[model samples]
Every structure is written in structure tokens, then in C-alpha cells.
Target: MLILGCMVLIAGCGCLGLWFAYRIRRRPQELRECSMALALLDTEIVWGATPLPEAFGILKERTDVPWQGFFGELKERLSQGESAGIAWKETMIAQNSHFCLKSEDWNVIGDVGKGLGRSDRTEQHKQIELVQRQLMVIKEQAETWSGKQAKMWSYLGFLGGIAGVLILI
Candidate 1:
């Protein structure tokens, strides 16, 4: 009876381990897709063109990732330009979406922010403050994503260990 109990436990653990492994295998693809999306956003910003609204819409539709108001303001600024009658700074503060940083657009915003203080005063510098704010948001979101992934991996490891112990018994 004791041996049977041990066998059962071992099977349970093995099942858990397999579940974790599957999750782990799937995560990289998600991350890769996310990274590629962000790269596309970066390309658009580098060219000084407005990002596709569809991209933002898709990101918003797909992920629960967090973002800041500043990104929206940046987008609006690019879309409306100086004549749009909206205060870029204020709009940045008002715009908030978890969807923003999940896409590649955040990185492009960061690059644009770095050039703000320079004498060249390119379009990149026009929204420097907004970009800086967004970069911070992106950094935070990346950390959060990493932490979650790590936790998932750790859980998988624990389950695997339990399975091994059960087998030994």
C-alpha cells in the first residue's frame, strides 16, 4: 500500500513536470513574437513616420502588458503635429494603456528621447520628455515580464523535483 501511494505521487508529479515543460517551451515563442513586434515599431519611429494604428490596436487586443500615458501622447503628437491644438505634455499625462509598451513602439520612443537635449534638435528631440517617460515604463514592464517568466520556470522545477522524489520512494 505504501509503495502504491508513492507510485501515485510519482505519477502526479511527472504529470505536473510535463505541464511545466510545455509552458516553458511555449514562453520563448511568445517573447520572440513580442520582440519582433517592438522591432517593427522601432523602425517606424526611426523613420519619423507615425506608427500604424493597427499595430497598437493589435497589441492592445492581444496582451495585458502595462504602459504609460506618455506613449499615447507621443503617438498623438506625431499624429496631430504642433497644429493639432492638443497640449502634447498634457495629452501624454492623460493617455494611459497597458498595451503600449508590449509592442516595439516603446523602444523607438526611448531612442527618440535620448536625442532630445542635443543641439541637433531633430524630430527625435521634439518629444524627448515624453519618450523618457515611456522608456521608464518599458523598463518596468520588461522587468515584470521577466519576473513572471522566472516564477513560472521555478514552479516547473519544483514540480519536477517532486516527481523525482516520488520515483525514488
Candidate 2:
């Protein structure tokens, strides 16, 4: 029973490490998806001449999770009479913990919120493009870090679990 308990504990710790690794690996993908979602928003707003709420509603339908949820929340907030910037900030604040994105990424996103519905279509397009560029750079950095650190985290987790088991024994 003692050995069994130790084994289970080690396995659980190892799984926790794997979860961390997975999160790291997912960060770059999430950033890239965010950039793409911004491009979609740009299209909806600039080319299609859609209103902020309607554009966000379109984004909510077309994007993936986190983004899908983000856009949906933004749409709902826009309906509640909040400005785009405030709604965006609140949404980011509320959902920040659930995402793998860092503060800088959120800042980049915040820029978009600040610009939304504040300027003409051309200016909005420029702001969205700037954000997309920033996100691409951040995504590249995240990819590099993920490639190196993801494996490290997984290994460290497993080793830490082994160390804990040894200490317990």
C-alpha cells in the first residue's frame, strides 16, 4: 500500500508537469490564433463595414475557443452600453487567468480594444495591422521558448516527483 501510494503520487506529479508542458506548447498557437482572429475582425470592420458589436458577433462565431469566448463576451458587453476599450479591458481581466498569453500579449490586445470604434475605418485597419504585427513577433518568441522549455518543464516535473517520492520513502 505504501509503495502504491508513492507510485500514484509520482504519477500525479508527472501528469501535472505534462499539463504545464502542454500549456507552454499551446501558448504560441494561441497567440497565432489571436492574430488571425484580429485579421478576421479587421475584415469584418474595414471591408464589411460592420459595427463593433456585429463584428464581434461575427468573430465569436468564426474564431476558436478563448477567442470565440472572448468575442462573444465582447459582443455581450458592447450590448450592455460599455465602450469598446473598457469592455475589452474587463473581458481580458476576467479571462486572463484562463489563457496562456502573457501580460505583453494582453497589452497588445488592449491596444486593439482602445482603438475599436474610436476612429475611422482606415485608422482601425492600421491599428489592427499593428497589433497583428506585434502578435506575430510575440508568437515567434513564444514558439522559440516553447520549443526549448516545454520539454524542460515536463522533465523537471517528473524528476521533482521522483525526488519527492525518494524523500517520502
Candidate 3:
């Protein structure tokens, strides 16, 4: 019974570790999803020339949490007549808990906040392109780290579990 219990405990630890590793790998994909959504938002702003609130409204419908919460919050803020810069910064801060993006990643996107809806279409387009490029870069780096780290974490978890079980015996 003691041996069986040790086995179970070790298995549980391994599962927990695997979950952590999965999250590590998944973070990059989540960022990519956000990046794609931003790209779509850019197109809407460029071609549709919609108001910020409405543009965000359109984006909110198509996304899940984080992005959904993100666009929805922006729409609400903009609809309430808040300035785009303030609204954006606040919303970006608010969404941090809902997302896995690092602070620098948030800062990268946050930098583009003030430019939204504050400029001529040409300037807005330029800022959007710049933001898109930055996001793509982040996405690339995330993919690279996740690719290598995914296996490393899994092995670390597995080995740690085995070590723990041996220690118990």
C-alpha cells in the first residue's frame, strides 16, 4: 500500500508538471491568436474606417477570452467617451491576467495604443503595420522557445517524478 501510494503521488506530480509544460507551449499560440486578431483589427480600421468602439465591437464577437475581454472592454470604454490612449492602456493592463503574454509583449502592444484613432488614416495604418510587425516577431520568438522548452519541461517533469518516487522508497 505504501508503494502504491508513492506511485500515485508521483503520477500526480508528473501530471501537474505536464500541465505546467503545456501552458508554456500554449502561451506562444495564444499570443499568435492575439496577433492575428490585431491584424484583422488593422484591416477593419484601414478598409472599413470604422470608429474605434465599433471596430472593437466587431473584433470582440470573433474571439475568446483575453481577446474577447480585450476588445469588449475597449468597446465599452470608447463608447463611454474615454480617450483611446487611456482606454487602451487600462484595458491592456486589465487583460494581463487573462493572457499569458509577458510584460514586454504587453508593452509592445501598449505602445501602439495612443496612435489608434488619433491620427489620419495613413498614420493609423503605419502604426498598425508597425504593431503587426512587432507581434509577428514576438510570435516567432515564442514559437522557437516553446518548441524546444516543451520537450525539456516534459522530461524534467518525468525525471523529477521518477526521482521523487525513488526517494520515497
User: Which is the leading candidate under TM-score?
Assistant: 2
The models' CA-based lDDT, in order, is 0.46, 0.91, 0.83
Q: Ranking under lDDT, best-scoring first?
A: 2, 3, 1
Give me the candidate number with maximum lDDT: 2
Model 3 misplacement above 4 A: none
In the range 32-110, model 2's lDDT, one tens digit per residue, is: 9899889999998889999999999999998888888888999999999999989999999988887998888899889
For candidate 3, the clash count comes to 0
Report residue 126 deviation for candidate 3 (angstroms).
0.7
lDDT per residue (tens digit) for residues 48-141 in model 3:
8888888899899987776898999999999999999999999988878877777888888887787987888778888878887888888899
Which candidate order results from sorting by TM-score in descending order? 2, 3, 1
TM-score of each: 0.34, 0.97, 0.91
